[model samples]
Target chain A: MKDTALLSAPLQVQDLTVSYGGDPVLTGADLTVPEGEMTAIIGPNGAGKSTLLKSALGLVKPLSGTITAWDQPLAAQRDRIAYVPQRASVDWDFPTTVLEVALMGLYRQLGLLRRTRPHHRDKALACLDRVGMSDLADRQIGQLSGGQQQRVFLARALAQEAELYLLDEPFAGVDAATEAAIITVLHGLRDAGKTVLCVHHDLSTVPRYFDHVCLLNRHTVAQGPTATTFTDANLMRTYDGRLPTAA
Target chain B: MSEFIALSLPPMLIGTLAAMACALPGNFLLLRRQSLIGDAISHTVLPGIVVAFLLTGSLAALPMMLGAAAAALLAVVLIELIRRFGRVEPGAAMGVVFTTMFAAGVLLLEQTDTASVHLDVEHALYGNLESLIWLDGFVPGALTDPQALATLPPELTRMALTLAVIALALWIFWRPLALATFDNGFAQSLGLPVTTLSLGLVVCAAMAAVAAFDAVGSIIVIAMFICPPASARLMTNDLKHQIAWSLAFAALSATLGYVLAGYGPLWLGAEASVSAAGMIATVSGLILGGTALAGPHRKA
Candidate 1:
């Protein structure tokens, strides 16, 4: 199964286990994210949905498991992966402009001490434009609304120009227009053959937004194309009766 | 001319250079919310200086700086250990480590007879800038004399070199430093060696403190480390602009405070000037307080 996953998927996690302090948050979880598809990982709160993504990104250590991205270790392929943490994780009042935050995505390429070249600035502006944040490029991050903040984060990720994107709760607390803008950008990434993994909470937009679904509750309950895996039974297992209505 | 230069100019130049050096890295420390580390390192270095003097039996510059740097690094390491093993907040860990180290330093000082040596505990805590005079005896026409320039105290030269090095380090590592300070996780994901970058910053802060502490005392060094950068932060949202503003504020406070210390006492009919280091710290605090109240970017 491991060999088959390596051949078919861009990302594969096998028998992954993780814990915080003493209790395990994830146990023997197996997942494979298909290439060039927008995959949504849906689960109840405290079900380790974000942990799964963090483990894959090497931000969190797993107790016992293997995660392979692009047929290699995550560390070796770090440049190809872009992560957008939950907006609430950052201090919005920090003294930085939107352009400066977006420019951070190019630090890897720019290296140490070197100024951001003209073309890099152009690329950053283009990314901001892609996310519809061009006009607010000079605004302080704290001054932006929740939706605008989310868009700026998307713009920063776009500046990375990575092959795979991992976004933690991108739509949480965002307005409708920002949600639509994010969805458009996700679709654009998918259409361009880039992969995206989002930790999504709202059950109503699962089918409309995602091409693949990974229903998780400390372990993988179901994983496959959205049509077959996003069943009411799998969601019940993932959400553990907290899911209000049957789909 | 010689009298003015000998009496007032050296301390002003020394204060400005020392404050600039401390404020440069203080900007990043403030951004990272580790401003107390400056205070911690400054206090802990006292023990290192005492131990180095005991070991070397001399008041040489290099030995004292090395001792101070070692002590600062040790303080950081201890703080980390306590925070990790003792599971306390970083501020509390720093408070415990620095206060203990400072007490040890004071105890060591009490055990030694330092009257014969130039090392005075009171002078160390509150610098004696008024005593830093040219060794050439301030003859007439001494301002243009090469021999007089050579006789200038080494403290001024040391501070000048420190300022140059601090500026160079900030310029050379601006990108990685900014990225790591702003977002450590993202910087690490980009394979930027965030841990090493953070350690380098702490080491730089330690070195700056060592270079300035002898002439300005830990009080002024601590104030400069937090005040100028923090005031600059309240005035600008851009990092580059913030650095520039911080340097400006540091220079302003040093010059203005020196003037106030020297002349303000005379205006009030006092016979002599007060402590230059203390006055500089007081002025920096006033500037910060004023900026916090009236700066354009003051938080609502």
Candidate 2:
């Protein structure tokens, strides 16, 4: 058949449904994120893009169906996945420094009751160095600008060292140089055979940035190679009922 | 004035130290939005103490404190389960779990028939530092003389030891606590066990609550748990600075409150019934509120 067995998908979400209290944000959404590639999920506001990523990370519980990663269930294999939330979702004013936040990725490995050893601290600094945030390691998170905050989170995800990386809107409020830096980091991860799935908002950069794409509006409109799948028709369906081809 | 000083100064010192210990953990709890869990555990520990008392019929601090910590830890696990599996909101889950546990504790007290043991809900809520002063001293061994010399207040010693243990715990887990409180998801991916850290925090908090129960009483411990850290948060966005400032404020408030409660009655033309514990709480609240209102929007 197509060696589907050997080429196992890193993340497989089947008929996933989620809601806030009662209103359904995603109904029967299905997606598969492959290993060793950069996949971008793009849509307009309220398109359930973030919801899709949240479900995958177990941040939001699915009402039905299941999600699997690397042939194992996502529930039992939490350490194997890393999530980078939207820049605005957290309180920057929280009394923590950049290095401290970056070290959070080491929490799972170090255990809650354990201290971050000199080695772990050194590793966190290394991730920061990769993201060019090593100089700002001791800066209070609240004092950082939006772009710096975004970079800090990326470094945190890097510190996680997970096989599967899920990031949401990392580029929304960042500068172009930071965006380029983030893209470079993601490209490096992809080249190293790690899977990266990012919920992105920039339509113009999709062609240049991502290797794969998932177009979604409640249900997944399309999923495949960016060149073959991000067609005018799919973009129109993702945006709304209005067709870009007819226009 | 000297008599009042002798009666209250020692307890006030112990209470201030206890409050400082509580504030260290409280800073993280407040940021994580788990401040009310302290109030919950403080109340729920009553039944545990009562049970331990009924079993021994002797007032021993160690066993009773262990029993209280165990009970509070159970309450925390239950809250986590309900929040995770039941898909309940955090606030609602906390309210339900704490209230349920508190009610169970009350029922346990009635069943144990130790209502008149004087560790009732009121005393548990509104502590009497006066009582702790008498808890000071060493019991002579059987081989020693029948008439023994008295020692310094054991309450002070216990407070000192408790604070040392708490300080050590914070020092070890400082980074993880900071990370988990700010971003749990990232912490988890990094392989940090946010749950274990949370459990450790609650256990430490429970231990502190039990340690201070004698000096600060259970009720006013909330002031210690929340006030200093809340006030410190207003002044700085740095975690280290918050810990330092909160400790300083806690020590200052305790001294000020102790001095005021002892001497303010002469100026007011009436005997002051307000305890140093209450005065410190009021002062901490005022500082917290003032700072929150006037503090810069830069941090937020």
Candidate 3:
């Protein structure tokens, strides 16, 4: 049973040690994401939540670690995964439209030479519609509000059609409506048998938004289903007894 | 007509072609906020030319261009090394490497006996655009004669070929280029070679700068690489329109600037013409300023 569980896991990171500028950000961290579930990695301000997420996607270099996705190395599983980095990672003033940003999701499939056609446009449009952003398809990315920009990013990731979704704080700095819509889409993805892992803030929403939780403070404090693992004890341990919450 | 073809046609066409070539990759470079890389590459090409002149003991085109290309690549490598190992920011590293290389080139120029050649700091800064005359173009209907074309300045042919290659590369890698420029981290996650693409962009810029350095000066190379694309960036919110606008602005700057430099003084009763390269750079900056004033998407 244990072997079957390991084989079926969507993402597994063992002994990840990452440092930035000679300062260790993550030290001996391990994570195993449950397949087809919404898993949240929550921790305090300096807990390396973002680092762990980026290291999994090969965006951050790991000092000593092995990252596997669906029982294979992360490199081999790149096409099978979609990553939604923080919205602040890109320059909002870049000259691209919403539809164009969404079409970015099809680049790996289009390879280097294949042109985008009508079907690809329709697919990207459908993703925008799923996020209630189909009307803003022609608008420049810089014109969108914070919540709208967050939705546009989610729409792009949805257009990827991947088996695993890794997001970095997708709900941060968004309106309540956008948050609800995003969570609904994420839950739908989980129900459709796609693995969803995200670096989440707002301890108040952990039990409500995520089905599984990994309480992390540099290292994995506890990880399991929300019912058994997201207790007050784990919350205090993750936040260092701060009892902080986000609206 | 013959005078126009022999004297005016070559430089004007060469200036236009060179402008368009640099502006093409300049679109992507501007978007990536690495516009100064063009400045650095153009400056570094100077030392390369001096070195090539030193080694070849002649003003041959091919060897000088090869040397320029090598130096441009070396400048890029040095900047990366400093940024990586020296733990310095990219801007500071670029400033250090390009300036040092350029200063060395100037020193090398002063040290070498180049009295016989048209090589000097002034010539490199303001090119011999007035001297790129095509005497073969003086023959009647020489425009249609293959023999006449054979005697044409090689800089014109080299610039045309360089422009074609840069255009083809941009066309082929449009999507990936846009993705990499917009968000490199996302591109990496998709298994795209973002690093290779970034390096390829620098290589393309270096190629344009080297080719253009022969006819136009470093001033126009750096100016064309930044000004046209930057002006176009304010004109449109779509990448396609941005590229198209940049090319149009580049052509406009080259033609108008070259024409004004060549004849505006003649019309004003002056005996000598001004530097066409400097005029082109001025015109490009003027266009950028115009766009900033009234372009539709000029706001941040």
Candidate 4:
């Protein structure tokens, strides 16, 4: 039974419900993300898309839910998980350099007296290189363009060296070139047997970018291989009987 | 020379140490957009101290600190509860909590027959800085003399130790603190104890405020906590450089403000020296104003 739990999925959520003083943002949201695949969670505006991800990361308190990664609580396996929050979630003008943001990914390794040794710096630099942000390592994060800023965050996540990566809107407001760069990196992560889940929009790019889709509004509308489940019917069902004009 | 060592040096040292202690945590607070927390914590200290004095019937430091820490913790918890349950914004929640506590303190002072003791609102606002005189400083070669060092004002030793403790805390928790302050969700995802770390930061700020409350007074600690770090934010894009700039700015403000308050009136042909704590806060404000005008990152 334990072996089945471990081998079945990288992430699973059951009976997840969330609300904030008003109405339910998400209700009975169940999801299962397969291991070593890139999955996109698509939904329309105010659809609890971000809430689902937040709940899974334990960033938000769900009304009724259970979440597990590798058959264990997320808290138990947090060291193997990396999360990239939305770009709009933080102040870009904060006093920090690109290299410093990348090094933040490695903070879990350092104990109380957080002294970044040479190897840590080397690791951070290498992660920046992975995201093609090595040249801008010394620059402040506020100085970067929107796309460059996203890349820097991606670099920070790469520094974590985790078994699973969860990104919220990795392609939002990014230039085409940066979008390409990000997808390539996501693909690399998948090829390396790392589970990748992204809260995504842009239905036009859904089938192109992701191998699987979890169509959601307040609850899971559809889930499976993109070719089979990411159909016009599922998109309409998830988006409330009306397909959004290509955004 | 002897006169300088006996009267001026101790107050100046106390002021500098106090300023440094507050300014260290001020950097993170300013960056986190929670600068008014310093104001809130310092204001709440009055009620805490008053309660402590009422309980112990004494002016000992430990009881005062314990009471202040407890009050600060309560204030923070209250602010959070109001923010979360009451749906009030964080700033508004803080404003309500701290001001109410401070008013309660004033009422307590009025209600109690504490005039016999040296506890007064005036003393809490503008601490008696000139009284931190070091009799040991009058000894020749006092810098090297162990006996003279032992005779230094307790306020000076305590302020210096406060500064050291705050600096060490900043250094040790540098990573988690920066991570949590910058992006709370990301830090939590990385398994950082975000709640504990933030509470620890507030504890550090409150500790500095309580310690400096005696020497620099309860009010001016806000300026030291704000102005230096705000100016440093304007000056630098790197947290490390910003911290260095704030420490330098803090020391400079303390020294320059002390000298100006002590001698500027004399140079302008006045009789009495003005308030050193007031002058220090004013100097820091002037520095902040200057940086805001011409700082490289001012636009940001």
**The best candidate in terms of TM-score:** 3
List RMSD in Å for every model shown.
2.4, 5.6, 2.1, 2.4
Question: On residues A1-247, what C-alpha lDDT tens digit does candidate 3 reach at each position?
Answer: 2456756588998889999967888888988898989999999888999999999999888999889998888898888899998999999999999999999988877888897899999999999999999999999999999999999988889989999999999999999999999999999999999999999988788888889988888888888898899998888877888868632
Off by over 4 Å in 4: A1-7, B74-90, B110-118
Write down the lDDT of every candidate, Cα atoms only: 0.86, 0.78, 0.90, 0.89
Fraction of true contacts kept, per model?
0.59, 0.64, 0.93, 0.86
Question: Against the hidden reference, what TM-scores do the models get?
Answer: 0.93, 0.77, 0.95, 0.94
DockQ score for candidate 2? 0.41
Q: Determine which window of 10 residues in candidate 1 chain B has minimal summed lDDT.
A: B129-138
Candidate DockQ values, in order, are 0.64, 0.41, 0.88, 0.80
lDDT of 4: 0.89
Which wins on lDDT, candidate 2 or candidate 3? 3
DockQ-superior candidate, 2 or 3: 3
Candidate 3: chain B TM-score equals 0.92
TM-score of chain B of 2: 0.81
TM-score of chain B of each: 0.93, 0.81, 0.92, 0.93
Clashing pairs in 2: A105-B190, A107-B191, A107-B192, A108-B191, A108-B192, A109-B191, B125-B219, B136-B154
* lDDT of candidate 1 at residue A221, scale 0 to 100: 89
lDDT comparing candidate 3 with the true structure: 0.90
DockQ, model 1, C-alpha based? 0.64
lDDT for model 2 comes to 0.78
Off by over 4 Å in 3: A1-4, B58-62, B73-90
lDDT tens digits, residue span B68-175, model 3:
888887987999999999999888998999999988887888888887876777767877777889999999999999999999888888999999999999889888
User: Considering every candidate listed, which one attains the maximal DockQ?
Assistant: 3
